[model samples]
Target: MTSTAGYDVERIRSQFPILQRELKGKPLVYFDNAATSQKPQVVIDALVEYYSMYNANIHRGIHTLAEEATAAYEATREAVRAFIGAPSTEEIIFTRGTTEGINLVAYSWGRANILEGDEIIISSLEHHSNIVPWQMLAAEKGAVLKVIPINAHGEILLEEYYKLLNPRTKLVSVVHASNSLGVINPVKVIIDAAHAVGAVVMIDGAQSTVHLDINVQELDCDFFAFSGHKLYAPTGVGALYGKRELLEAMPPFHGGGEMIKEVRFDGTTYNDLPYKFEAGTPNIADTVAMKAALEFINGIGKENIRRHENDLLQYGTEQLRQIPGIQIKGDVAEKVSVISFVAEGIHPQDLGVLLDQQGIAVRTGSHCTMPLMQCLNITGTTRASFAAYNTKEEIDRLVAGLHKAIKILR
Candidate 1:
């Protein structure tokens, strides 16, 4: 399944078995990719292969199954390092998901480095996962949380961000791409600016990793987190990439097996770089499956996938704008294949329900960005997000479904 100069979208779609299923006698139109992507057959097969063939714990056992399982699991760390262009596998730490990854940094790094009167900065377009963990950390440490405002276009105010950075600013954690608006944030610029102010930056890459090319070293961000589920792998598996120095300095996020090299009643010494944070047995099956997902993305080349998805975004945006009452949110010039919009006189939930009945799936409501919803001066928007496997024909179906919903509601 190698990606070529000419993208074979139909061939690509054929690889995902779930895409073939019909919903209510109609072909499924999955436009809710921002929430989570459907897995390819290869990824599914990897999961089944792991359980059927190995089915053992990793890192501790000397037996054949354990050795194979450990090797496969560690192979994912290397795959992730290459996928994101991190310097070393030691920098990659597996966690439950983006939410858990963020929480780990907040608990480990935040608690260690932040002091009273220190400030952590984030943007207005952040998902609640990025917001709440920091809020909890700030409250606990007596540190202040500041937000960089966005324009109506859903972009972070660069000047405001600069003004917010100061000696007191200790961390700047922002999303690589907004889940709600689909705006691809200028994370490199954000990272550089934060570095100028001596602040460590953590990028929430859950959305961007699926649609954009990521190079951690190029961006020079101190930390990066993304979910495997969003990248077409199984749920409960994700990775956090942190600078080796920072990861080494931070305390262990969890206390349990594999995190300890030595333990006694009086004292305990933690394990090395990644395993210190990755406690317990871990999600072995899904972690192994993540390598397959990354391989799938690699086989189809990130640039090829990006180009196809960009076409979907452009075409979908143009077609949706033709509707009389449609108002698109986050009309940023630089964005991924995501469109959040509201139809006049129709609630987002109502529109979503109607679209679902027609076998078009879309995410509705605040999309876990309630603060962003408030910033947009709306309760919610119906979001149609695309993936490499999605087609313009599916976007057309989504547009038709929207019209049907409008006709019924209005």
Candidate 2:
């Protein structure tokens, strides 16, 4: 696909090998970006180079290969620090993904601080990862789990959220962007409000990191979590950013070799700040390759990508709105390149199958936000999320595919 626009959409698309392939004898149209992004050539090359040349353990190795591997792995941590505008690398800890990051904070910090009769507040716009861990933590700690309600527009009602916050509010966790509806919550206001009540907040950036600019310092969130795969890197690797004081105060998430200072029968001394939480060897190769993914995004500049994707989002939403019996979900101005809708007479899974037959990829389901689905009065939605490399042509194809699919379904 090509574009006659200010941005080089073709050049960006060329860097992704998967964009050139054919699915069902048709050019692939990838619009499932919120689920996970397609990696560029640089990222794939980094992975091969790491595994082929320097496949060694990190942080504890002295050999040449091990030193090289460890440097590459740690480089990604620095890159993540820069990507999120974090204060220091000491505050960043690598994890299996955003899910692990949330669980880490919940188990470590939640257990340490939360007391009986405390309240943990989450929003209606959270992914299952952000919701389940806190629910479990609140239950275990004899703390109450409360949800911030949303309006009919699929947005977190700030007024209602304020009403929920009290002196007893311990932790407030929320998604930076709604995965199912694509609404960007008013997190800054939410964070500041939570702080007013002496509550620490966690922002789940799984769906926002790639599409939006993130600054943990500017956001003033106590903890921030994001998945690497959502940002064009490989799966099974993500980062959690915590304030230094909070991380130091909280206990370690796991007990293992790397996370230990000295292990003895008497007592085990944990390692320093970040490493204390990172237990095992981790997904070393993927973590190393994650730097390449960040570099790729940095080269193009996030502002340019955002503008291009915003254009695509506008075009896609306009084209879809014209189609009959298609009701777009979360019809709001403040959002990224995500469009979720449900057809009047068609099931989301069936619509997805038909679109897949046309080589058009879209996510169809509750999108791991069952509570949000229930709140929105929808069983599921057909979500088409865009990335940096996507174009108006692909969205046109999506519209055409939807028209054909809807006709048959009706």
Candidate 3:
């Protein structure tokens, strides 16, 4: 409960108005952060201010409101560029979410580059967003989709991954962190290996962008994708970061209004880099507020937040290990503040429902990583993930809830 290094968890908790609400009769304990984060008052204020003051469409109008709205929206692009260490704002393309970002690459870049019999490598740790788009692309292009295997600890086997690569390998797409298991993959190494085989790499940063320090240029990944909702912003906005050369070579994602330079009946000339991919009216309010969310994270300081969350992870893991018949999925040392575990006799769905009754919210089922669940030889696991505002006290409540659930279920 003490504020160390200027990080006051209680102060942070007060900023989130929803954290004060009760789910049942008890106080709320929201641990479903991997699914989506709760927004602070600052981010909420940004949305309200945008809609209340300057609610105009971006890029087209030179009027006062439009200028204010457009500047705010584009400020988010610069924030994302600095957040991920992208070379320029031109490489940062806005989308609906991480799913749309990957789909954008698969549709635009993958369509142009991939050939029949060419290979794409993904890992066992990927979320469905990373897997499905490539599956669709592979199906359409007659390309081979290969999966890099994982060990018993749910860590990627670098040796096995190397075996999957060849001159025929076209792209290597993977999740930087596993949403289900909470295992952080060695992506920098994966990127280098794929490049050795003359392949481009795309990282699914849906989970990593919030927890880990991401520098896409240092990682040398061709593309990176993440969502805004997961980063404590609104639901409808996210971003895709690609290399400048790769983005220029790839065709425009969608065709319409702002995405085009000139619209003639004979043919259309598309706009440059980012606008070319951003078709139609964008999620202006949420995208504008996303800048506030980024600044929120920066204000608290990521390393400072990571330390507190890591402490919570250690404490939670220690407490949960005492519960009988409980086995943690991906019981590895390398992970963010996420814990996924299966009980011997009880179903995960039952456990989650029991926790919810106590107002301790957690994610149940496969977490969109069904293939990972199948690989782990379980139906699903109950997931309790943490964020900056979470506390050791909440983990205690979760542990107590789990103890009660197991007693009743067994």
Candidate 4:
């Protein structure tokens, strides 16, 4: 359970107050990071300060308070643009979360570009957010939704994906990292192949943004989306990064106050770039906090944090493998810090309940990936995900709790 030296795991743990509390008189072990990471103090403080000090609607402001609030909100857009390595701030659009971001693209871009008899490519491992959006859009547009098959290990079959690409393929959206199984897909290659056919690619980065270094420009992806809560920020805030030319071509997602350039009885023109997509009064406090979360990651250095988490994942995988009768899912070389497994003769829900009794938190059930669970012919799995604040000792505690839970269930 010893952490690697040079990284102060103890000091890092102190930043999160929830980690300090005990569950059922035992030290709480949180491993449901894929669901939502616990926010750091800096992000929390930014939220409090924004509400306490400057709370006003952004854009079209004249007074000092409105100007300060507008600057803060716009600064978050710049931070998001930098965070994803987007080409311009105009390409960054704030949304409720990844779900809304995908839907925005589905409704706007999908409806505009995809016509009848066209195909939309997606993988079998996609979460419902990724799958359902395209499905709904395809049904609306009369376009066929084609699924890229995955192998037994839950990794996408790239050869099959390449074959699926044709002139009829209009859009390709895939998860950068699987939430249910921790598999990291070859997004760069996927994007490249999709672009070869002139089809636009959108990466659902809900899980990968926190664990991996994202360079949207380098990735050459048409669209990228991620949630703030999963990246140590508050909920109800997320961003969608699109290419400038593509964003300009698509229509606005929601029409309201700031999104419009001028309003008349005849018609109205939308605002430029991002504001056109961000309609109504936005999530001011959470948007400000998201910038702080990005700054916190930069302060710690994403590469160093990723290295530590990878080590934890390796250690956890090895330790979990030693436990008898444990069926590990998605044990592939290319993966993030997600592990899903099922104990023989034990239901996943039962295992989660037993682990929680020992102050350990793990996710059970389909994890919003019913199709992925069905692909593996299992009802669900017990998922344990890692984050920057996680330590080696936490993994040890998790393994110990899993063993005890298995024994109790048996």
Task: List clash counts for every candidate, in order.
Answer: 0, 0, 0, 0
Error of 4 at 107 (Å): 0.5
lDDT of 2 by residue, 1-410 (tens): 55536788888889999999999999999999999999999999999999899999988888999999989988899999999999999999999999999999999999999999999999988899998999899889899999999998898889999999999999999999998888999899999999999999999999889888899999999999999999999999999999999999999989887999999999999999789998988899999999999999999999989988888888889999999899999989999899999999789999999999999999999999999889988899999999998988889899999989988888
Model 4 segments more than 4 A misplaced = none
lDDT string for model 3 (226-301, tens) is: 9999999999999999999999999988888899989889999989989999999999999999999999999989
What are the lDDT figures for the candidates, one per model? 0.93, 0.93, 0.93, 0.92
State the lDDT at 138 in candidate 4: 88
**Per-residue error at 21 for model 3, in Å?**
0.3
TM-score of each: 0.98, 0.99, 0.99, 0.99
How high is the lDDT of residue 257 in model 4? 85
**Ten contiguous residues with the weakest lDDT in model 3:** 1-10
Q: Give the clashing residue pairs of candidate 4, or none.
A: none
Model 1 bad stretches (over 4 Å): 1-5
Cα RMSD (angstroms) for every candidate in the order listed: 1.7, 1.0, 0.9, 0.9
